[model samples]
Target chain A: MGIPYFPGCTLHVKAKGLDDSTRATLAALGLELTELPEWTCCGTAFPLAQDNYMGMVASARILAKAAKEGDGRLVTVCSFCYNVLKRVNFALKNNDEARTKLNAYLEENYNGELRVLHPLELLRDDLGFDSLKTRVDRKLKGMKVACYYGCMLSRPAKEMEFGEPENPALMEEFVKAVGAEPVDFPYKTKCCGSYQVLNNYDLVAGRVKDILKAARVRDSEVIITSCPLCQFNLDWLQDRFADEDKSFSKIPVLYFTQLLGIALEISVAKLGLDNHYVDPKPLLQAG
Target chain B: MTSEEMTRKVKELSGQNPYLCMQCGLCSASCTGIGVMDLLPRQVMRFLQLGKEEILKNRSIWMCTTCLICTARCPRGIDIARVMEALRTINLRKGNDILAPEDVPAELLAEIPQMALTSGFRKLSA
Candidate 1:
């Protein structure tokens, strides 16, 4: 069956590897990702100001497209996009005044019937981890992986009802399903400083340092994440910090789908392992 | 505007009752930007409750990455991140943007992820 996929802005442009790997991984699992027609960005951030109906209009248009095109399920790879789309979906359903105002901006009124889903939710809830285990051809044995949730996928508990907001185990379950050991790290659901990387690199560097330290101390060989922003911050900041901090060790940050692609026996190039700032190829090949 | 007006505006914009905050400091305690923010999360809520209009002008609101750790951990179920974003919106709507897209160096813009650029513009731009 085909699912409506919204690659968002980041995945469509800068994070093609994540988009490619997500498509390949899902295709291997007997699910086809059909891109929604004429979908724009999910406004990147959820406009928290109740008065800003334009942001809701932008997100509502995307949901409208998903409702018109696919099976009323919009799958997103980027956590920021997922959060924005999901929150907007929640508001459009609950707030009548806001919904009426936002609907005025759209050609067809969205009745909040569309469901926004993350790739992790699709794998865990839809595909079932057990089913995924049965298809694993190349087991990631002896691989110590740290599953980073990075806020967006599991935060604002009311909206993102995927798992435990603070300490999600869905990725860990997926790792175990692929036959790899999931490391328990304290900073798994911690924020990676999100968009602060644009202006405040030092603050992000400090947070990334702590996140990586927690994983490394747990003896995790690599880090797996679902968010493009989290992957970019964790991977790119590691390179920036490596020059300043001599004790800093580089850990390969791969999308969870990339790791799943490896366990599914998909080619390394197809998973976009080469596109990562810190090369995951060595550790992935060694596994 | 007076402090009462500011508080009223915040409550209206965020649709969150700041009076519900019990001062448990869970929001402040869980905030990741505590080191950078001049006023912590709990303090930001306190400023809103006390109708301190100056809180809108504080740099603490902009420093927030909207990570929602505070909102997730709030004992009173207050959406502190939304409150913070409301403060930013008030500031931005008043023609006080933290950063302009034209001012950002092309070299730095090219290096950062597209998510950062897009979300930054949404949050920081007027």
Candidate 2:
């Protein structure tokens, strides 16, 4: 009846739309997302330094608690959190030294027994796409959607283990199940300039520019993504500098959950479609 | 750290061996940040192999988003992204913060997601 969910920091702050839509859509699917009690940030970006055992503590704390909770599995929507948590889980499971050091530091014994699931994996593995197609009342019949994986969903392929790191089909498969057409673009697995958005705004915008154009070229009305950062860069940067480029038209980028809410007949208001910088409401309504 | 120590430190920090690279240039080709990088990913590996520390000053290491595209494409099974992180860790641990939190404009920080700020500081700050 319930699944322990980790929304991470972004979902609580600026990316409420992703959180709201995820909760709303999952509720519609007959699953309750119970936020784990006393969950803190997953320490975004898995610390790469072997000596940075301190960096692993935050996520380790979360996983240790999730292990004792209702279901032994923990799910998070933030791409960074998913990658970090999953990588930490993988690291803790494989390396005895890391597990011993981290567990000693955290004062808990967690041998990476935690199962972290992204909603996409849940839909494919648990919900079953065939059943999802049958449950849809407001099927998104004619809309062409381009799903952007944008790095975190599947990368360092051995660790994340969700989909193909290159040319991932999970998001596209979800689109097809909802009766919408999924358009494949080259930049689907590409990085959206990530943390560099802070240091070089233009460089980050330039990357987003390419991503938007690639999706638009494929004739996708909107691009959907799982990462909040990816959604922010791809969606907001276009509106931030729209006037600067007269030749390029603005396109909407949205969280995949928002589209899921739509396909499942969750109200547009509840889906947080209006919160986006490049509004997909007009396109969704028209379609 | 000296040029000799840089290679050893990177191996110690990243747990990835740069010496295994065959100069395929696949990492550079696979990098999404190659557009802005002064030193290509392949060149970073080459510099490490040559025991050259000039890679520390290159803007490419900072520009790298650490998406791991190159790590996946490496024929030698090198975690090139970890190598990039190690290069950054060297500078950051020395208190050479590339992105100062104080310099970020108030408007953008107010608008940017908390994860962005957290990850930015984690990687860019000491």
Cα lDDT for residue A119, candidate 2 = 90
Measured against the true chain A, the candidates' chain A TM-scores are 0.96, 0.97
lDDT of each: 0.85, 0.87
* CAPRI class assigned to model 1: medium
Tens digit of lDDT per residue, candidate 1, span A212-258? 99999998889999888899889987877789888888999999999
* Chain B TM-score, candidates in order: 0.93, 0.94
Residue ranges of candidate 1 with Cα displaced over 4 Å = none
Native-referenced DockQ of model 1: 0.75
TM-score of each: 0.96, 0.97
Error of 1 at A223 (Å): 0.7
Among all candidates shown, the one with the greatest DockQ? 2
Please state the error at residue B35 of candidate 1 in Å. Answer: 1.1
DockQ of each: 0.75, 0.84
Residue A215 alpha-carbon offset, candidate 1, angstroms: 0.7
